[model samples]
Target chain A: MLRRVRYELAGRVAFPLLNALSSWQRQLKRRGRKPRANPFGPPLDCVRKLRELMTAHYYVGRYAQGAVPVAWVTSGFPIEPLRALGFHIVYPENHSALCSAQHAAIDLLQAAEQEGFSGDLCSYARIDLGSALTGITPVGRLPRPDLLACCTNICRTVSYWYKNLASHFDVPVVMVDTPFVYGEAEPHHLSYIEEQLGELIEVAERIAGRRIDPERLERTMRAAWEGLVLWGECLQAGKAVPAPWTAIDGFFHMAPIVTLRGSEQCNSYYRMLRDELSDRVTRGIGGIKEERHRLLWDNLPIWHKLRKLSTLFAERGFNFVVATYTNAWAEAADLIDPAKPLESSAKAYTYVILNRDLEHRLASLKQLAQEYRADGAVLHSNRSCKPYSIGQVDLRSRLAQDLELRVLLLEADHSDPRLYTDEQIDNRIQAFLESFS
Target chain B: MSTATAIGVDVGSTTFKAVICDGTGRILDHLIEPTRPQMEQQAREGIALLVERLGCDPALPISATGYGRKRIPSARQLTEITCHALGAFHLTGRPGLLVDMGGQDTKVVRFGSRGEVLDFAMNDKCAAGTGRFLEVILHRLCVPLTSVAELASKAERPVTVSSTCTVFAESEVVSLVAQGEPVEGIVFGLHRALASRVAALVAPLAVKEPLLMSGGVALNQAMVRALEHALGNRIAVLPRPQLVGALGAALAVRNSQ
Candidate 1:
């Protein structure tokens, strides 16, 4: 009972006050800088609010233990059910991504490597394990998980990554194994995932020490579904000739949907972003000063080099108007039916680009290219993401032949900067752009 | 008489080359030297020496290309890939494929009929299909760079050295040496390995006919023969192939003027 009191105090009073103070201080710092013109239109006004929302979330997490059930889950895991159970969810993958963006991942990666983890392992997994072992994180503190949930819809690595977390924390692990979908998912595959989701609820119910509520889950699913719909609308704004925003902006803006889905704030945030982007489109504003070439990006971003990479292309009047990675978040929104949450989630998660066959991926790439009116494509042959990078050679050739698009296969890792060669990539990009001349 | 009009300097990994070209794209003067560690110093001194030797005006626009193109304070900087394509297109006067195997990189470039680069592929951060691989292996095997082609030609049957990694291939070559394999056969085998690697990069492209070759490695007679055998096509070596990148740079600066 006392723990509940303390939790309310932290969530409602202390964290909100602290977050407000931090936001005010940041605004003061921002005011000192010269108000230079931004080619990508003015910066998003709600960004500081976003920082406040995320900071309060993490800050409140410190007091979540003993007050509510804590479940550490994958980014793609079915989290709506957990929300219905009143669990305080923590996404390690998202946190590791934050670490990667801040360039704090290499030290943590080295820490994991020293403890027998291979350097070739997924960087997110390494950063998380390294944080777990060292009790170090950019987030104030990660509440100890009462449950670990993992879904294989993203990749096979998450299952093992979560299992290790479960073993270390000595907690129960709930696995939602979505079979890889080739074309359309087999009915059996959906049933299998539905059954696993049912088991997941039981596990989450036990952890929460309460009964599962179907009506609450329905409400959560409705919000999640609406949130995704808004996100898809936001991304569709990129079809504007100059594009209302760049893909780098999209990469950062995706945080709310990834971390705060199934919440009112998450839905409202997307609505705001969508409206802003739509207004930009109507005003003839573009993401870059000049948009000479519209290219489509394939695979994950180089988190460590976003600034340098974005500037290089921006200066060349090249802007990546859309990306397959960011679109993955929105492409499956139509498949999510709130009426039958479990069955639809099973289907939607299974059909993600990573889980589908190369043919489906190629078709999706073609559709996106046509829809976005991309003149060329840059396919990153990422070293860390084999699931995403496999069969790209064939895809590159097909895109060129079928779409008559120029394609460049860039070899680099998304998270690890050590794998990138700046000089080589510079030469390749210059040559590619020169071809257009 | 054609006077020294424009200048180009190519600061490559293994060698530095400079060319002085007249307004008509005709070469009037040229210089070559082993590249020094301090690229800025070498590029400055090399450009001065070339201009002095050619009795050229110092006010001419100078363009630079290669790995250290930016190191040289020049009027224009272009990548070796573009420069090589430009030089090859001028040399052949026709649209075709170009294969330039340098010290550290191997490129397969396809240019349009008017000397514009259409498509290209380069070996990824590896020295297997490059001049450095042969240099290291030959130096280890007690064979001089000039003798590699002569000795490799004498071997009736070549031994196979299959590793694509430079370090591993060196070890494999050493193991073959320990087994009493003939040096000439081993050298020829190394050439074949490199040829096959370069061929794979070209296999995926719809290569234009009348394939052209350039760069320092193209001077190797055995490697050229191995490449022709692997490609199953006649290879035309550009005139003074080592000067191609420098010549391209000179042409670019002059055209810009």
Candidate 2:
């Protein structure tokens, strides 16, 4: 009970002031920034709010242990049940990315490697496992998880990665294995996932020592539905000529949906973001000062090189208007229905594009290019993500043949900076953009 | 006829190509030498040789291209892909497929009629399918680079060189020789193996007809023939192919001016 009081004070009183202070400090330092050669337009006003929301989440998370049962979950896990069961959730992928962005991940990655994890394993998994083993993270601290949720809808690596975490923390791991979908998911497949989710709720309830109210789960699903729709709207604003934001912006802005989903906080944040983006669209405000060629990005971003890559294209009047990675979170909204939350969520999480066939991935690319009116596409052949990068060579040809758009298959790892070749990637980017001129 | 106006240099990984070109982008005089560790000095010396031979002013504006492009003192720099596209467009006078097989990398470039790059793919990951691959394997096989064409032509049936890796193929070729396979067949097989890797990069591009070849590897008639067979498209080797990047560097500087 005392732990709950500390957690509440951090979330309600302490974190808000600290977040605002940090945001104010950023604004103060903004004046001292070299102000030269900035290619971006007016920065998003909601960024301050985003910082507050996310920092507060992490700040409050520090006190969550002994107060609330915490479950470390995958990005694609069906988390509504956990939220309804009053579990403090943490997405290790998000934490690893934060660690990457902070430039603190290399040591953790090395720690995992030194512990005998192969270098070729997904960097995200390696970093997370390294953090688990070493208790190192950029975020203040990850509350020790009492439960781990593994969903194979994203990748098989997560199941094993989370298994390592379970062993390290001595916790129960709830598995929701989504069978790989070919063309379309069968009823049996959906039923199978739903049965597993039923088992998940039972395990979670036993751990929480309480029964989950169905109404609360439905409410959480409804909020998630709203948040996903708002995110879709925020992304659709890119349809505007001179998109209101860039895909890099989307990559940063996606934190809420990935972490704070199944909550009113997520919904409220998106509502404010959606309105701001819509206003930008109406006012003809672009993410960059001068938007020329609209391009689409596929696969995860190179987290360490985000600023360099963002400026590399932006200064050249090229903006990434859409990305398949950013679209992943928003695309499953249609599969969600609050009335039958469990079944709909089962269908929703089962049919993610990564879990589907390559044909669906291609079709989605084609549709997104047309909708976003992309003149070029850069498919990041991520070294760590085999599933995303496996069929990109064929997709490059198909996209070029069908759309006559210039496509560049870039080679880089999403999280591990060690694998990136700076000169080679820069040369390709310069040549790719030069072709537009 | 146009006189020498601007000099361009391509400081490639294995070779340095310098050319004095006229206002119309025609080569007046050129120089080619193996690249040394002192790239900028080599570039300067190569330019001096071209200027002295052409009897042009020593102060001609220089534009640089290739891997060591930025290392040279020059008015402008461009990547080999763009330079190859521009030079190929000048030679062919039309946009199509261009395969530039240099010492360290192989590039498949598609360009527009105006000499602007449309698309390009490069294999710089290793020595496979590059001029260096041939150089290494040929030296290992004790075959002169000059006799590659003749040796490959004499083989009625090329032996299968399955390894695309340069180091692995080196050992593989030695084992084949130990097993009494003909050296000529092994050489031809090596060319075929390199051509297949280049072909894989080209296959996804689906470039149209009127394919063109350029760069140092274009001097090897055997490699060109193998690429032609692998691509199943007739290739027109550009005139003074080794000087194509230097020529493009000249044209690009002129365009910028």
Question: lDDT tens digits, residues A25-76, model 1?
Answer: 8779989698865445567666766777777778888888898999999978
iRMSD for each candidate structure, in the order shown: 1.4, 1.6
User: What TM-score would you give candidate 1 relative to the actual structure?
Assistant: 0.95
**Alpha-carbon shift of residue B213 in model 2 (angstroms):** 1.9
Model 2 residue A380 CA deviation in Å: 0.9
Model 1 pairs in collision: none
Runs of candidate 1 with Cα error greater than 4 angstroms are A30-32, A35-41, B3-5
Q: lDDT tens digits, residues B93-155, model 2?
A: 898888899998899998888999978898855678799999999999999999999999999
lDDT of 2 by residue, A1-437 (tens): 99999999999989878877877888798876787777987889999788788888888999999999899999999999999999999998898888888888899999999999999999999999999889888787989998999999988988888888888888999989999999889999999999999999999999888999999999999999988999999999999999999999999999999999989889899999999999999999999999989999999999999999999899989999999999999999998999898899999998898999999999999999999999999999998988889999889988988999899999988888888888778878877887886
RMSD of 2: 2.7
Q: Lowest lDDT 10-mer window, candidate 2 chain B?
A: B201-210
Residue B148, candidate 2: Cα error in Å is 4.0
